[model samples]
Target: MLREETAKLLMMIQGAYPNYKPDNKTVTINTWNLALSDISFDLAEKAFLAYLRADTKGFAPAPGQLIALVHELNTPQQLNELEAWSLVEKAIRNSIYNSQEEFSKLPPLVQKAVGSPNVLRLWAADGSYSEQVASSNFMRSYRNEAKKQEEYEKLPADMQQMIDQTNRNSYSAQIREKNRDAIQIMTTTENAEIEVKDEPTGISQQSDERLKKLIEDFRKI
Candidate 1:
């Protein structure tokens, strides 16, 4: 929201709660603008109205609270666990022959829970598959996926980018650690000439050079 819009919102809040007062009006406006600039004025106003209707405490909402309200207003309605399970159950009826089509028709969250068309087909063809167990599992998975998507959507753009970068870095570190372990195992089993030394230094110079070369090769990979 723009500075003017933010000021208008604060005015609305102040009007609602006469006792609420800010030490510095200009600072408050600037702070609110900084927090809500990504939101449009219309959406912010709607969020304010929604909060006003639901508020039990007569206190004015903080900037962070307004942001949360904005996100709540913006998020699309999601199917409940029972409703999602019903869709899956319907799809399973035709999954034996038209699993791909049925799977494609499901919502993204439902598709994530189902995993694949083949999985759906398996559930349909397998007589031993229990509807009670499958329904419970699919509902649980759907709820989990929905929650993850909601939380991710509520995060700020910068925070989302930071999380993505952290995940990538963590995955890269795992891969590197696995490769290092594999290289160590290969060195131990494949290179008999390179021997461990009991001297002050742990490994022989030849073994050290070979290990260094292996590390460099793994780095390239």
Candidate 2:
């Protein structure tokens, strides 16, 4: 936010908390501006209002607190673990004939934890598969994915960009390594074929004659 917007927010805070008298007004504004510049003024104002309603301490909020509140405001509502598992259980029951269709109907996060339609089919077909075990595993995976998404959403735009770039780089490196290994395997196989073709003719003939004699002996027996 701009310095003027930050100053306005601080003014609101000062009015709310009579004892919140900063000795250096200019320094406080600059600090708040620097900390909150990435956030929009409207969002910052909303966060301030939320903080005021929720706070019982009667103390003025710092920039960090406002940033936290903004993240909370921005997060979308999500299903709890039990609700997510209930959907999966229903899908599993119906997956016997139309596994792919059932899989497609799952939420993105639950779909990730379930892996694929083939997995659902396997679980459905296996009488030995334990519903309790499956429920426990799915809930754990769902919780982890939810937490990861929440943390990612809370990151600043710049930080998110950096993380995305790093992931792209890592994926590119893995692809390159896999290609290199394939090339090495193909080269080694080609070299082996060349060596076999270049073997002494005398040795090759003897090996063929021995194979023919063994075939004749087997026929006679």
Candidate 3:
């Protein structure tokens, strides 16, 4: 899935604007990380290679080729250079480039993934760490949230069936609730069977109370 997503996105960008300087820093890795986690440099290499193939043979990209489909819609027959260039700009901004505002507006899972430094691992070594670091709190929350989501995904289909769990329906709304409850709202109809993380703890008992209070106050950060 990660490879396919990477392939489609690279294909879209390259197909649209062949002359654009490839900024692996300003492009490719981060948005790809958000849209498709588990995507490594190896997968990206494969995606770019496949993109070259698509360019050569005009072969249809695999089934879930969203950007390919979108580009096809934008320029069906031989695209005028200007139209192709325009689509390239849009695709670069929408896919290759990373915008904080755009990241903030992503679906919860995408937002969560984008919220983490680990997701932007490729760019870490590019001297942008001071300027583009993901906050520890944000990364922690993203991981916590992603884990609960993974748990929800692993539930048996028969145990928690869905008819229309679209962005407008149960799936999107539940992503906003704090982690454990969000998991329950998605899957555990019984509620009794759900697993929640242990409540936040402090160093000790009497001092622990004060520590907990201090921690909560700090979290208002």
Candidate 4:
């Protein structure tokens, strides 16, 4: 992935600086070898692509500039009040913890996002809080969905159709997996019942109960 990204970046650089003829390759392969070792392909490619789009003056950034951009991307900033609160709401709804004590033991990121545990507890118990939290959450979701839909609309007709088909195939695969699991569970239950019936009349009630419990647990999974 890094090599592929490196190749794309080099191509972009050559396009931007056509006059800068090189004695060697577009980029020294050895230089990329060292850079790729430290940063991920996604970070490098995203930063480079962002630079290409934002730097309208068309001055090519040096290779070190790309690495610096990766650092800028990694540096975390304080979230605004709404973003922090939305994250807290998401954690409260989705986290496995069932009690305040358990919630307190959640990851530090979750703790910090909540801003204050007391406020979270109060909001969680308030009916009005749900509407507010949901509105904030929905706003973010709507913006993301709108952006994706806008991008899709910009694509060529054929490309849009291809993406739609891929999404359909993914959904179909998930349905098939669920069906397979259901069928397996039913077949296992029937087979177990048959085995129990075939057992000698001396089979204990405890053994029958154990088999039923196992089947119930497996089916839940």
Candidate 5:
């Protein structure tokens, strides 16, 4: 059922953009459909819809893009374990420290959770960590700890010390919420500029007044 749907989707994409024919000599349609066989029908359809709606001029969506879209949209539980393992693999590659140095840098809690040096080296160096070891719990803990450390480093020195002394988890959440509010307000103000007055002198004065008001409002924030 999904195979046939995939075939139809391929045809739809080609039909929508006549100039964008995939290199069938390198990859046949059957092979592409086979690659996407594991994806559910609903996910495939949604991905196709999203592809069609994209504001691209002339390009067919690749098979890999469709697979990625399914992963991004549905994110099934079993696939999450695989993605978590991939994150561990990425961290290993991205680490500046050698195996021993990186192993030592793990938080005590993470070290305890990850087990011995042999296992740590396998995870960080060889990408041999099992899905069981890289469970959702470990993924969440590692990501949260990394995010906290990153945010802490970005703070002013005094603010960092104050947060450390207070040891308040809510402080991070408060900062994130404030950032979100500011972004929303800015977006609203930008979208509110619906009218463009075009008289020469009138436009110049209006622009000056609007700029001044914007600067004043920003400073108040």
Candidate 6:
């Protein structure tokens, strides 16, 4: 799990170090090694956050030493474009370096773009895949809405389709994003999908109690 999150953090930082050349040679946030000393499913969430905070004050990157260590983690070359970008981002973020005057001395444009929350979260997921899955939380209610339709289909001829299908021309969908902080809710979704079946109660009831409980839990965040 931490590996998944680390993969995301890498993607975000790659954006920070775009190929475009900056006026200043100084590096703002030096990413050291992303590979944690150790990790497991238990510490996945906290471990994920710790990597981001690693770039902050206390966890400043070292000199060539830390940066040199990044090359060791071997992400597959066949990774999608987004995946490739994330692997790079994680490397730079976790690479060795510090908030030296050299980094601070850089201009504001570089600072804001690199340190932005969206960027941070982007990197957290390696790419938007996990984040996208995460977003399914509230929006997944739409699936319940879909499942409701599926249920209604199972109904006798007397029943009505209450789902207000969207028009093709006005098909604007809002995407829910996942982040390290809000990851567990995604897990609940998988569990919900398997357990929440339509046959037990039938569409008349449309009782997706399991999925509902998970979505409600995510809403708290």
| CA-only RMSD, every prediction | 13.6, 14.5, 19.9, 15.9, 23.7, 25.1
- Candidate 4: 10-residue stretch with minimal lDDT: 94-103
lDDT (tens digit, per residue) of candidate 5 on 1-221: 26577677777777887887767733556776676666667777788788778747667777777766665566422323345445445545534224334445655435434443344444544555565655665677655654555445434457767986776456655554454444334333333443433444555556556656655655554
Runs of candidate 6 with Cα error greater than 4 angstroms are 1-207
Worst 10 residues of 3 by lDDT: 183-192
Maximum-lDDT candidate: 2
lDDT for every model?
0.78, 0.79, 0.41, 0.56, 0.56, 0.35
Each candidate structure's TM-score, on Cα atoms with residue i matched to residue i, is 0.64, 0.64, 0.21, 0.31, 0.34, 0.18
Error of 3 at 159 (Å): 4.5
On the 0 to 100 scale, the lDDT of residue 12 in model 2 is 92
Measured by TM-score, how close is model 2 to the native structure?
Answer: 0.64
lDDT tens per residue, model 1, 1-221: 77988899899999999998999999989988887877889988888888889999887888777777888877778899999989999999997666767877999889878876667778998989999999988888888898898878767788889987897679566665655454454344333433433342444455566767767766675
Write the number of the candidate with greater lDDT, choosing between 2 and 3: 2
Question: Looking at model 4, how many pairs of residues clash?
Answer: 0
Worst 10 residues of 6 by lDDT: 70-79
lDDT of each residue in 160-212, candidate 2, tens digit only = 99998897679555554454343334333434445677764655566555545
lDDT score for residue 35 of model 1? 79
Candidate 6, backbone clash total: 27
